[model samples]
Target: MAANNITSTHPAFFLLMGIPGLEHLHLWMSIPFCLAYTLALLGNCTLLFIIQADAALHEPMYLFLAMLATIDLVLSSSTLPKMLALFWFKDQEINFYACLVQMFFLHSFSIMESAVLLAMAFDRYVAICKPLHYTTVLTGSLITKIGMAAVARAVTLMTPLPFLLRRFHYCRGPAIAHCYCEHMAVVRLACGDTRFNNIYGIAVAMFIVVLDLLFVILSYIFILREVLQLTSQEARYKAFGTCVSHIGAILAFYTPVVISSVMHRVARRAAPHVHVLFANFYMLFPPMVNPIIYGVKTKQIRERVLGLILRKDV
Candidate 1:
């Protein structure tokens, strides 16, 4: 058994030590988070069902949208359930191994989501900017190849994180201050040197997230140029409108991550709580809003989903 006399030397210890007014707020916060999780699950599942059932949505864009929905389901479910349990049920204790496992999946899925967004951006670019060969360019086999490559790239980039985390010796503190397992939080518990983990984490973040953002931006730039060259104002408006949902989804996913990263470095005492809240929002908000975005923007998917619900009622 690990010693129970261990104490945390993390910089945020004082803030987490039963702060006034904030100590018991977890219960209340869990209510909204639970609602968000429920909505995310239902919304993403509905999107998936609509995509699978509607034969008209068998194009590359819808296929990528379905893939995004699937990723959102896995991504949100990874942390929200345990977070809700911790908050609502007062079950805050977690085994070290379980915490590490949770961190692994959380990071892995986040990277995968970033890759999927990049793929979606590329798909849009090809459709709008290279309409002459859109079908030949984004065939089923090509989409499969892109999906496989994204998965492989995410796995390869994240594979080292767990191993690096395992190198540290934890100080036997089982109660994490935040609602969910985070990479920096877990690593801070280590009694050993953590410089390597910090460096590696930053490197992976730059490679997967920063690089992916660059690619997405470039894709959109070309897409915008192509749209401007179109002679028909109606066609240009339609093409630009089709991209609004995707742009919103990307902003929803990446903005919180950027904010959380900055908060982690500058506001050590408050980062854990803010990070947890925003992390939950970042993971679930996209999933919850994505289906609605697509439904409002894509006529065929909206019609098919509504038709299916109406038929079931009849």
Candidate 2:
């Protein structure tokens, strides 16, 4: 049955875009990716469990953390399994609809992650810069509304991508050279001009990602200024300490994305595999490290997670 499905659909490289000289090691190369996938799932799941079970963590910051973990799980799941299948089972063929679905979820979760980061930044800004109004500004209702807005923003931004993709007629050699159905790789297969898609993608990215990053930076700037104004050394330490985890997470998430974009454009030949590896890192690294960041930075979550682990061991 599966063989029939493979034969019926045109064999476009849905995810596993093989590198030029590294095709031979594709299977072996996947070992690190397998490890990454496992660690991401386990770590993010642990974070999710800690947030859910701990009543003290029912605040807006942990709520955003939980949402981020969920987004990471979905984002990683959308790409990694297909890449693993291609590497291990030699099943590189994916139907057009399946590819579209993958692209949608991948992009959606990515946008959502960016939005969540922005929300987290806002949370920090309120808590640090406006401690007096933090309770009023970041109410549970407001957080729920922000979460909805994030989802809506993701959906609205990604709505046009699939429609644009559907208009294109793919040409021969539909092999995608990456590990997953990335926007650039899939669009490159179009026989028709993709200038519009590229333009719109850039516009959307600028609006969503760049704008969110700017907000995060501005929020931190305000936070830092407020922290500096505090006379008490203990108070200053407390203010700075709250943001350490968030700052670390933001760097881990965005730095790889910026690096990947530059690498993709400058080095076209090796870009596919490099792109795949870094893209995976962009999604997985944040999730895997987020728990550690929180554990090291947040006293409540750290103690709860440790207590839970020790209880299980006992």
Candidate 3:
């Protein structure tokens, strides 16, 4: 029943094209990609290490930053290595199941990142708007529960993707036009009708991105109202200052996603390599920028990092 390594349902492997229509530039393109990946790894690791080492950073905001760093590490690692392999060594083949596993980690961690951002927004809102009750509301136990709930939601929602993809019959060749095994890219190779997968994928993406973004915006609105009502201008500035890092993180994470999603729907107008580049950008950009945003903007993280550097120099 298995002919040429393809079973009745799927092929034995999928060939990942590093970037469609830009094969000639793969080697050149890998330089920036590798640099970004390296930065993402080092930056996120430093964030985690500093947060863990500093007892002063055990509060909810910094804990959420720690979570963000952890998720960025996993999320970028999921695809960047394989992408580098493809670009540098021409190792483009991914086993069918391995592709699915990569897809799961990539998407799940991405959703977790979004949820963590929303949690951070809530944290900022409470700190500014309900300062008296901040401790009572976001205790250590509640933060742990929130983290668990984020993981649970992502897992429960994404667990079905692999199963659903398994049902499709892939008659199209095993060549995928993009670097990673994105849900839509893989679904396109299936000869069978993909209406369900398309609908499901869009629905899930909208549910996560839109719903989380709406709440994040709402949280900020309340925060803004509370800040504006403060009689002291200095108090208002201090409150707004606290949210700068979170705002940067949110923009860094969501902007690429939003642009890439929009481009996907209007694919015919844009070139193939453009879409692939944007996909890679969204996957790599947030992780690379997040630590920089926090390190530069958050006073505590910056001071801790400087302290470590000075100690090492001594």
Listed per candidate, the RMSD to the true structure in angstroms reads 4.3, 4.5, 2.1
Tens-digit per-residue lDDT, 1-314, candidate 1: 34323322222221122112355787777678788888889888998887897787889999999889998898888888877776666666666567667777888888888988999999899889888999999999999998998789878877787677665556645455555677776676677668888888889888877899999999999999999999999999999988988898898888888887787778878734566666666767877788888887778878887898899999
Question: Which ranking of candidates, highest TM-score first?
Answer: 3, 2, 1
Runs of candidate 3 exceeding 4 Å displacement? 1-8
Q: Please report the candidate that would top TM-score against the real structure.
A: 3
Residue 157, model 1, lDDT? 78
Please write out the lDDT profile of model 3 over residues 136-242, one tens digit for every residue.
99999999999999999999999999998887678888999999999999999997668999999999999999999999999999999999999999999999999
Candidate 2: stretches off by over 4 Å: 1-15, 18-20, 266-272
Full-model lDDT for every candidate: 0.78, 0.81, 0.94
lDDT of 1 at 128: 92
C-alpha RMSD (angstroms) for model 3: 2.1
Comparing 1 with 2 on TM-score, the higher-scoring candidate is 2
Clashes of 1: 0
The parts of candidate 1 lying over 4 Å away from their true place are 1-21, 266-272
For each candidate, what TM-score against the reference? Answer: 0.89, 0.91, 0.97
